[model samples]
Target: MLDVRASLGECPVWCSNDQSLYWVDISAPSLNRFDPATAINTAWKMPESIGSFTLRKAGGFVAALRSGFWLIDRDGRLERKLIDAPYDSTHHRFNDGRADAQGRFWAGSMNEKRDANTARLYRLDPNLKLSAMIDDIMISNGLAFSPDGRILYHADTPSRTVHAYDFDETAGTLSNRRIFIRFEAENDRPDGAAVDREGCYWSALYRGGKVVRISPGGTLVGEYELPAQCPTMCAFGGPDLRTLFVTSARQMRDPEELARLPQSGGIFAMRVETPGLPEPRFAG
Candidate 1:
């Protein structure tokens, strides 16, 4: 575990080139890099809350911050604004996201109020054009692509539903949306997720204190219990990509609960039998 104790840790992206993990603490409004070899972590403060980010092929990162899409350098400096916030920043902010295999960055927004469905998903092309894709979402969270890059999986946390879409990699479009998985537990909401080499979807269950692996057909295959109650996201890392890294949250927890789970916001890891695909970098 990399025990930085973040307020709300999310988006754990592995950098195979450096063998380090890049992640964000949304509530802390910072970007962080963790070196497992030395147990050292470095952080870059952001001007505002940053939801998610993907490494750019050209260098640095393309981030989804409170204001909108922005290009951030390796040192966390905001280099350029890619687009303005399409939704009202006061009520919504970009949340979970990543770059597809074709190099297009896709991100989804969340309604902070949790009382309305005003959030939407967006796609940023390599040419720098931004387009809205899905709408009427409440808490956009899980975002991952199949190993073959032919299917996209997404989840609406508040609704406890994960959806699959037929992806047209060449055109960067989604169609034939259908339910991939649905949680029946009232408190178990699907959060951030990742797909393994075998096409199994691994999802972090927020408030459920566990991570679940579901086959491509939507059957639950395995479960990994976590000490933290609010695990926000998971990523595949390590030299062999067999290490599953999970990020959690400490914000808005009861004092008693925080006392029980001292590493509530720390990053956790476990070895897995299957490896994960390398994260795709933004072509832009």
Candidate 2:
């Protein structure tokens, strides 16, 4: 497995233009970028907790912070642009996010208190406005849009299932919620997910020690086992979008377990047969 040491690696995203993989470490308060060409790693420290991010149409990225969403310049200047989430408990914050075909940003939250229901999902526009999409989320993890942008896929950790919604691209609305796929409860819960060009879902299991490739009809076609327990997220990167980059986490592990798995919090890579859909850009 390709190794990328991370403390709590999450939110893996592929930047085709740069041919690199990017992700965040929320607990670590850092951002990561890996250059496949040189096998090099780069990290940036954040002033506060950062849940996830998406590419901006103009340049740079839009990131979700504990307080709200913000615009991050190429040089790492962070400007808080959205403040509508004041109701979010301080213990809970933004988590995984993905862009819709129309360039709107969709992100979810997780409860820091574990069993509490203070979490929710949100949709943010370039103008820095926040809209609540779903409520009572336990842990908003990975999210992705369908190849045709007609379906939106989302997963809440420890739930063991990924949910699908009928996406209204023009009106930015979601309906017809249904369970798309379910992972084994004995295994890790579904943490993050991505959709391939063929519309297959690539879901990373948190403690399951594997990533499962499921058909749109909910059939398991394949699996990729990982050396770590908490594989958080996955994204397809590379010149041809055939490389799968995965992020892992060290949280929730005991000291002994952490010692046993040195690569537990690092990133992993593998080659895949199918290419991934082009990541939708943020409307901003």
- lDDT (C-alpha, whole model) for all candidates: 0.94, 0.82
Q: How many pairs of residues in model 2 come into backbone collision?
A: 3
lDDT of 1 by residue, 1-284 (tens): 88788999999999998999999999889999999999999999999999999999999999999998999998889999988988999889989999998899999999999999999889999998989888889998899999988999999998999999999989988899999999999979999999999999999999999999999999999999998999999999999999999999999999999999989999999999999989999999
Best by TM-score: 1
Give the count of colliding residue pairs in each prediction: 0, 3
Candidate 2 ranges beyond 4 A from true positions: 1-4
All candidates' TM-scores? 0.99, 0.95
Clashing pairs in 1: none
Model 1: residue 175 alpha-carbon error in angstroms: 0.8
Measured by lDDT, the strongest candidate is 1
Deviation of model 2 at 251, angstroms? 2.4
Segments of candidate 1 deviating more than 4 angstroms: none
